[model samples]
Target chain A: MVKSIPLTKADVLHLLSEIVDPEIPVVNIQEMGMLRDVLLSGDSCEVLLTPTYNGCPAMGIIEQDILLLLQQHGIPNAKVKLVYAPAWTTDWMSDSTKEKLKHYGIAAPLHSSCVNWLKPDQITVACPNCGSEETLLVSRFGSTACKALYRCNGCKEPFEYFKCH
Target chain B: MTLQEALFNYLLRLGDNALIQGHRLSEWCSKAPVLEEDLALTNMALDQIGAAQAFLKYAGAIENKGRSEDDLAYKRAERQFFNNLMTELPIGDFSFTIAKQLLLSSFEFFLFRGLSQSKDQTIANIAAKTLKEVHYHLAHSRDWCFRLGKGTEVSHEKLQNSVNALWMYTDELFEMGEADEVLMEAGIVFSLKEIKPKWLELVSGILDDANIALPNVDYMQTGSRKGIHTEHLGHLLSEMQFLQRAYPDASW
Candidate 1:
């Protein structure tokens, strides 16, 4: 039987980058900045992940996918740990990912400091579909807690705006 | 309480507050007056449970007893819970529920804002993340309070009575205990005394805008810091803890 070389951390990260986020299939977890760090000892690997929000439902699926991806890539012993310190913010998401989200019909998150809940007029949300500035908030909440429902009059299309934390 | 014990107890109070309030909100799952309201409340409930898990997990780590977040939340007896009595009080009418949230969410917003500066890195980090959510919660509840208070004759009457009834319980949120004293001295926790005035100003301003009178309540309820809660908490725990009790060590 021919033996194969043990995978390195770079190899593992490259392979894991192929796994797309279950919620937003257009962006990989790495591009979303969800993969905090990866540590390898012998053939075993440990991945530290931080969730976008404390209760993001996507975390469980991402953790499972990470483990499965590692296993399929010839690493049998991979552990994924969830950590809360240095809590995640949308700022971690790259500019490229934000553009990808907009192209996929979901508006990217705005800067958190600019959000004033009392004065919706203070914030400007552009519709992802028609790129129009005339968007009304349909609801403070959308399909998920992290998103807000907005409707664009220009295109008459309702879209989910990823809310800033 | 020793400093370590005080820290543990403080964490329990924070965690229990989130857990109990989340459970109360979850009860409106399919029963809300509208579908949007149902989804909104449940979303808030999910955020609270997430906060509860984080605080309780840290508490367990500090205790060094190997108790996970589930063990602390599900296995604890009613008397052992340290959530404010206001949280465990029954969710009465929609008006009452709105009033409850207005008070609780305002309190939480200020509490988390101050706690975000905690000397303990873990607590500060968690508080920073949750503060934004609590801010939105306060906005939602306060907006609804104004609408319900000024809507119609029936709506105004119901909302007025509900806010007045919940006013007395608001004082209990500021009741300090040994745990609070210890944590406050260490800069690991904020002084509830300081947060009270800010909360009162915000509440009073909203009530004024809503054309509702502030109740002159001298008598205040207390005893949550000492693990004393209303009868409603026991029923809530029974329902919440049933699955864990029925199947010990069960995992999916």
Candidate 2:
């Protein structure tokens, strides 16, 4: 008979790294900085996560995914808690992840959201579709909370810009 | 009031406004003038609901009540609710929704910005996060104000009426309670008096550019902070609370 191994913190981390963001499949939760900490004590386990957006529906899915992955890995006493202290920021997103987002046809943020908000007109975003410098913001909101709709003047294609925030 | 009570009341005000306002915006689903507008309103609704959850959850904890965020949102009566009356009022028209969004989003922008500086770390964190979302909502509605305001005579008239009709409720947004004084003194909350000027300046600036006149009204509608609300809030609560009230503790 095969025996189930008790889940270690390293085991949990390795399993969690496999979980991709439900909305943006290209990036894993680890890459997005959603996985804050995972603690394993005896049979109990707790995972702390920070929300990237206040109303991002992906949070529920991510929580469920975490638990399912843990359960499948032979861990039963596990829970996910959402934390708000210090909040979440696009700055925490890595440059490599931004490149991955651009490859997925969504333009990455051009600057830190903290500094860009006041000088919105001065900030420019290149088109992820055509890589054009001339892109006009179609709307502040697009298909989701974290992205804005933009139209490329060069290619005339509309694409989503993962907003500065 | 003790420090905890003041904070609880303050959080209830924050949560109720977002809860009621988000419901009003959700009504625009499948009904907005355009697909983009539909998405915009609903997106804003989702953000507000998320904010409401955070505030209410904190409020519940502060009150030392076993009530969860869902309980505060779903089980509370209308008079028990403290959302600004303007939020509970019906979604009048496309122009009216835009106008209300402009006013509410702008108020939230300044309000949250001030709150980001709160001495309370949790409130500060939520405010900072919410401010980012409200920034987009404000810009979205502000752009529409320009379009509908300058587009055509009929559109302009509708937009003007919305702005004027909503002016009366604007005063209640800045009303400070004795409880708020407790938090304000402790540096846990910002002064609404300080925010009112910033709100007025932003609102008037947009109205000026949109060619809409600021409403001239002597008597502004107040109360709602203390649970006194318009008749519309009762009706809104009936719809929002129906499923939860019918099936107590029911969950998927």
Top DockQ prediction, candidate number: 2
The alpha-carbon deviation from the true structure for residue A25 of candidate 2, after best TM-score superposition, in angstroms, is: 0.5
Tally clashing residue pairs in candidate 1.
Answer: 0
Mind giving the per-residue lDDT tens digits that candidate 1 earns over A1-165? 434428877888888898787878999988877788888876558998877767778888988898887888787778998867677777778889899999999999887678785553478899999999999877666767878788999999999888777
Query: Which structure among the candidates has the greatest lDDT?
Result: 2
Colliding pairs, model 2: none
TM-score of chain A of 1: 0.90
Provide the clashing-pair count of each candidate structure: 0, 0
Candidate lDDT scores, in order, read 0.86, 0.88
DockQ of each: 0.54, 0.65
State in Å the error of residue B183, model 1: 1.6
Q: Which ranges of candidate 1 are over 4 A from the true structure?
A: A1-5, A117-121
